[model samples]
Target chain A: MGVFTIAKTITGNLFSRPPTSRYPAEPAKRFDLTRGHLAFEPENCRVCRVCMLRCPTQAIVVDREKRTWECDHFRCITCGNCVELCPTDALHLEPAYRSPEADRPGKEFHEIPAPPPKAEAGGETAEA
Target chain B: MAYMKRSPWIIHYDGSSCNGCDIEVLACLTPLYDVERFGIINTGNPKHADIFVVTGSVNEQNREVIRNIYEQMPQPKVVAALGICACSGGVFRECYNVMGGMDKVIPVDVYVPGCPVRPEQIIDGVVKALGVLEEKRARMKAGAPAEVPA
Candidate 1:
């Protein structure tokens, strides 16, 4: 009885598909909440510097005056601290990770364009 | 590129790590992520390895151990820094004993950034290191320097 059970198990193992996924040939599995890398959208940014202040690793740098935001990929821990703290929802954790690099690609910089001046009520508008 | 005739063997070392990245590194060897299909074997001795996988941040004490392991690997070798800690010291950068990333002690061929790197990312880093290994082999074949100055 034991011999027969062992033989059946061996047959099943021989015919079954391997558990390993072909990672390089195929894309790795990703989840909706996977924290692979940090992303910043400059357009939605208010340059409040909230993420910069709360980041544990100090990987984020926000220049309010220049409207520039930067994150050092190498230094970042992908902990989602800045993503949650972003008041304007400008920061997010992307599902696709930053690819490995041969050398350090310094800090990723984004220059947020200054918002256009609001028009005053019953005032002459300046035409470009 | 065609020069590689054998599978690349790797040796893993843990510096002053929290063991988070090390667990992920071991996960790469499990059936779910099985790195063996790529002809990557995890070896114990540094002399028998072609790739060095290091986890954690360098500190005052383990710096020498990291250097010794790096120096033991043969020529045409590649080093893959497997986590944010190994890449740039992670949260321990401010620690008094921490000396930053693996680059502080040895040349790093690939940098995979994650708090505790996922197994998929580790595979990606290893694959990237293979490319670097090929280039280094080519340089060695041509009688040129294997590593460029930092």
Candidate 2:
């Protein structure tokens, strides 16, 4: 009992946490160069549907006639190809490595809606 | 040797990829990610591997090669598709050469989802496969399953 307990205790002290994993609490630690989710600015979208054509799973659906665009969060591959090809600088990648719920197959994840058009920054004045 | 057996070897196979996912997969093997501590070795051959990580959606050209590789792998093997492309035929959804995710052909044991799958995410899939390996080993030891893959 004396020897066994001591060895176990010492081993536990020697190696406790997995070095690479800092998960479920602090968020999966993102490396500086890591690419996360791609931000989509629908207003900047040209309706060219290039992103739709390039998506690996067709995760991004564009209905040009309806002027509606939404990304199914569940289906998004986070590949960043859309961000790379966006000519308007509307799409940018942000790293959020952790997907809170990965196993739910039928649930739909949605992107935030585009804000209404605003006055040009230079032309806008203080409201009365 | 005991540790080695516990830490089964895995091999990465790319049929066709845009390279986004491939880079992510390799990131796991790097120091920042450090997948090696888990005993996940990137082996060069199928016979030496317990896990075959197919990273890209299978295309018409690569489909035969993948199948042949799968056949050559020893028994008690598990196939893991490491990205959306390999999992659900991601960006190549409508591509003519790609039939679908790897599951369209192989019995995928675990599916890691990401544009190109995060290092931790891929680790999650590997952990799941390890569970399957444990179960199969237990069944074999109990003499309940004869054909269980090693």
Candidate 3:
């Protein structure tokens, strides 16, 4: 509406960075409680069932008979409740939000990590 | 019609999102899509808008503000609920504080459903909202908006 309004707008835009994010290709700036792929660090996992018990949607599944932990990412709410309640600090939110196989059709993407190579069963894995 | 076709304003609200959809909504307004080229403005004030774009499940803390904001918009407006969260509570349906989707709070005209709907989808939804406005204007001119049966 005013003569100087145009000038003010141009100056304000010059100070701001472009808004699009280049993720996966470049490391993202991390944030607190970032809702990302839930990383299950099995090294420290005690198989306590704490993450399983605290999850709201039952997205976290632990087969006590098999001694395995799983998460169906498509169903996860990313509430960080499991990480908060886990005593082992085994489950936590990762900085990388995008999942691999993002565009694949019909094949369920963002799968719960494959049950750690079963010691009793024969599968492709490392041995202790 | 001419004024609306020239400068369409939208108010984007995040009810109780995890912020994945929030970032994508912001991405649509950025250089990637450059929605501003279409003269679309994302405003914080609801009274100045002809469109409402909502993301996330309507939580207890935000349902009141969301409803009040929808009511404040001038007539002949459209609401495009973005992401699966706003569509039908997406993956957060049963949370203790979540009040389901924004639709449970206000009437939604168009729904763009995705985990976090892509920028192109967001643009398509906005364009659809504009089309709804044009259709409503035609109805008002033809007296079709009045005396309609339930």
Candidate 4:
């Protein structure tokens, strides 16, 4: 009886498809909530620097004067603090990781255009 | 040099990691991930390795050891920094003993950044490293000077 069970198990293993994921040939498994990487929308960014301040790794640098937002991908841990704290909803956590690179790439920089004068007025009114 | 692509042996070193990334690295070797399909074999000797897989952040204690292993590997090699810690010190960057990422000690060819890198990402990083190895070999074959470590 034991021998029959072992044979059945062996045949089951042999007939079943391999469990390994064909990652490169096919896409890797991803879910809706996966914190793969961070994405920034310069137009929506208020340059409040909240993401910069809240980031534990200090991976974000926002220059309000220059209206520039920069993120060092290497330093980012995908912790989502910036995503959660962005008052303007400028930041988002994407579900696909940044591709691997051969050389250390420079920081991701985006020059946010100055907010429209009317939007600035509205923002101040909302704050008040 | 051509054979390096067919079967690239990698040597892994833990600098000061918390072992989260290391576990993911191990997962890549399991049947589920099975990195061996790409001819990747994790080895123990640096001299036999074509790629260096480093996990964790570099600290004062492990810098020299990391350098020694890097020096032992033959030319036309590649280095893959396997996690956020190995890439840029992760959350430990501010620590007094932590000196930043793998590039601080040795030139890194591929940077894979994750708090604890996923097995799929590890395989992706290794594939990227293989591409780098091919480039280095081509450079060597042309008798060009190897890249100077920054």
Candidate 5:
């Protein structure tokens, strides 16, 4: 009785469709909330340094004076802290993941445009 | 040479890590990722492997072991550092024992950076490693240096 049951199970599995997905041929399904890679739009950033301060790994660096934002891809754990803390909605998590590179990768820096000079009523605008 | 392109056996090793990346590395062997679909075979012995898949960062304790594994693998081999830990020591970089990335110990051919690293990324890294393997083979045939100078 036991042998017959085992045989049935083995045959059942032999003919069943493989659970594996065809990954390269077809892109893998990813969730909207899936944390894969981080993207930054410097133009939208205010250079508040929030993302840099909130990053647990200290992978992000913000230069307010220079209006620059930098993140080390290798050091970043993709923890999403920076993305959540970004005030300007400049940082976001992309569903697509980082691909392998032949050469060792490095940190990327983005330059944000300096804020426009503040307008003064009936007066000249403040120099940036 | 023909078999090298079709079937690239891999030897996986963990240096210093929390094992998050290690689990994801194993996931590639599962049916969901099924790295074997590309004729990849996960092997235990370094002598039989064409690719080295290392998870985690290099630490003082495991430096020798990592080097030994790299040396054991036959020529025309590629190394894929899987995950942020393996690529650059991740959060452990400041640790006294941490020694940075796989590049600190061995020459890394491919770098796949992430926290634990997704199984798909590992598969992608391996596929990229395969391309590097082919290039190395061609270079060896041409009698050029086996590796590009830094």
Candidate 6:
């Protein structure tokens, strides 16, 4: 409101560091529990439909008979409900978000990986 | 292209939502994420906007409003659905008043999927929308019919 205020504002603008984050050019700093995206580890998945049922938006579609799991990216709210409800810890939240692409909606379908086989009698089981 | 490449004004509208994504959309304008560096200007009037950024879902009450806004914009405009709600209605899809995504009312050029949509993701979505805007301009120059989905 005064001439001194204007002079001070000019001096501060000249000396202060810019507050803007240089994202895209530099990596974004996501927090430890940031729910950016969801990951489905088919190897650890037991073809359970818990994630599908637990999803509030019904974004996940699990076909246990066909051993296929699919997620509609656009439809997912990234609420981590599926990740939290996964019994085998097959579904988890990733800190890295999905990059924006062309106008088309994305849906990912992944085949369930086979569970590790048991070792021969009296042998130690392979750890995942 | 030179003019559009330098400045692209945006219009932000909030439909049926919890207002979380709306705050993130506004965050992109703040100094920390400063989307203005890309020459994006947020405007309220749809006629002056080159990009339409929508947050939240399209409900029965707001469908007409969204359609009218999209209709007011000139050709070569892009629409960004800024969160899971705008993209596919989020947790409100099953609500009796909710009709679904922004796409249900108008063509959407980009989708940033998140609960509240991070500022970085919103900026990324806008960048992708800029590409679509270029394509729409080219198509308009070519005199091809704009085959936007109904």
lDDT of 6 by residue, A16-62 (tens): 98888888788997999988899888877876687887788899998
What is the lDDT of every predicted structure here? 0.85, 0.68, 0.68, 0.86, 0.84, 0.83
Interface RMSD of 3: 7.8
Per-prediction count of colliding residue pairs?
0, 11, 0, 0, 0, 0
Model 3 clashing residue pairs (backbone): none
Clashing pairs in 6: none
What's the lDDT for residue B66 in model 3? 92
Stretches of candidate 3 above 4 Å error?
A1-128, B1-6, B144-150
What ordering of candidates by DockQ runs from best to worst?
5, 4, 1, 6, 2, 3
lDDT of 5 at B109: 93
Q: Per-residue CA lDDT of candidate 5, range A28-109, in tens?
A: 7799988888999977777667787767778898886676788889888888887776656788999888887877657788
Model 6 chain A weakest lDDT span, ten residues long: A119-128
Evaluated at residue A12, the lDDT of candidate 6 is: 100
Tens digit per residue, CA lDDT, model 4, B14-124: 989999999988899999898888889999999999999999989999999999999998997899998889988889999999999998888898998778898988888
DockQ of each: 0.67, 0.18, 0.07, 0.70, 0.75, 0.63
Candidate 3, A1-128: lDDT as tens digits = 77699889888789877554442234555577556557777656656676766676566776656656677553455678888877657778875453322111211222233445663343212111
Top-DockQ structure, candidate number: 5
Model 6's CAPRI class?
Answer: medium
**lDDT tens string, model 1, A1-128?**
99999999999999998788877678989999998898888877766677888888989887866778899998998899887777668889989988888787657999988765552121221111
Give the runs in model 1 whose Cα sits over 4 Å from its true position: A118-128, B1-6
List, residue by residue over B19-60, the lDDT tens digit for candidate 5. Answer: 888898888888898877778989999999999999988988
TM-score of chain B of each: 0.94, 0.87, 0.89, 0.94, 0.94, 0.93
Q: What is model 5's DockQ versus the real complex?
A: 0.75
Residue B120, model 3, lDDT:
60
Clashing pairs in 4: none
lDDT of 3 by residue, B1-150 (tens): 233465679998888888887898888777756677778999988989988988888988898899999999887777888776786675678878887767687877777655676666676677777877777667778877621222
The residue pairs found clashing in candidate 5 are none
